[model samples]
Target: MKFKRYASSFLLQIALAFFILSCGNSAEKKAAEESNTETTSVETKQKTILFFGNSLTAGYGIDQDDSFAGLTQARIDSLGMDYKVINGGLSGETTAGGLSRLDWFLEDEPSIFVLELGGNDGLRGIQLSETKSNLLAIIDKVRAKYPNTKIILAGMQIPPNMGQEYTEEFKAIYPDVAKEKNVTLIPFLLEGVAGMPELNLPDGIHPTEAGHKIVLETIWPYIQAKL
Candidate 1:
């Protein structure tokens, strides 16, 4: 019933998967791999970068290695920086869900936490007020748990299914939350890749490997600044 609601919005034969059941994402695997090979005091001292969001952050239809989060790890490793990137992107996640699952990721202190939800909320016509509340709550949770953790909010946009007024306001959610909370904001997570058919998979929802590469660039500037 839930999928049926959003699937109707897309005029395509392929169902628009707002929530593709993701078994797991590459970010988790990469984080585990790094943990396994790492043993040095310096590695132990490395700061953590947690990319917390949905399928985009998880690399979705593409190989996890091709996801933007994976590219970020590669870049960090190449630079010999002491930061580990963990992709906490889950498919079919919303702001409320992200908030609920946030505590599990908080067991360890992360130097940075990137929030990348709400697109799913927008797709489902969730109330803007509720979405905003959840965003603030998630940020607050991290701050309360780890005062020193820097936060970055990734802005998201859904197709104009709910009307232009709603779409415009929804797009503003990211900056609004960022300003109210004083966290860094990535203006649009899918800046160059969102609607481009070549950049997305056949589902027309998830990004292709090339798209993730582009996404990596969109997010790198913000991610790089904190490093």
Candidate 2:
């Protein structure tokens, strides 16, 4: 009888051990499943951004990560904001080129747009009317297809060599369009870096890496307000 009791006790201990292991496995599986669910939720909540512009937007002389768009995206991410900025800048893209591709970009239906065009038009001495018309067309298309998308028109200034009359006409185009279209206007995208040699790259035009920082500082207040 004593031997039988001992065997029964041993069997009970074995059963208890098995039950504990089974419970532990179940708890581990539940934890793993919950972790996976949380990961998926975070990924799904990410936001999308669309950036439209020229070489300035593309980070010509600097690493892609140092570009204005890149810096802006990093800022958004660091701030723990849900956003993904798509870089749509072409090396020598003009306002006309951007207008041509409006239909294709509109398919994404971005939540916001950083409109940084027209600089090449000014550099190339393109007709102000033509430049304005192209920008206006882009604005119209954006308004029609994605009315809720907030547009931040990044403006540009003309060089003194371009002459006062021509420069004024070119400069006026941005505010005029933004006013008419009711979009947010960031006057002078190169605000602090334009005439400052220290802030400019070798081209005497595009901003250096430091220049991009200035650009960020100049537009950040406006961008934050809109956000």
- Please name the candidate that would achieve the greatest TM-score relative to the true structure: 1
Per-residue lDDT of model 1, residues 42-82, tens digit only:
46686899999998888887778789999999999999897
Return the number of clashes found in candidate 2.
0
How many clashes in each structure?
0, 0
How far residue 8's Cα lies from its native spot in candidate 2, in Å, is 39
Q: How do the residues 1-227 of candidate 2 rate in per-residue lDDT, one tens digit apiece?
A: 99999999999999999999999999999999999999999678655667788998888888877878888888888898877888888889999899888777777678888888998998888989999999888888888888888888998887866788989999999999999988999988988788899988888888888999888888787767766
**Deviating ranges (above 4 Å) for candidate 1:** 1-44
Pick the lDDT winner. Answer: 1
TM-scores for every predicted model: 0.80, 0.79
Find the 10 residues in a row with the least total lDDT in model 2. Answer: 42-51
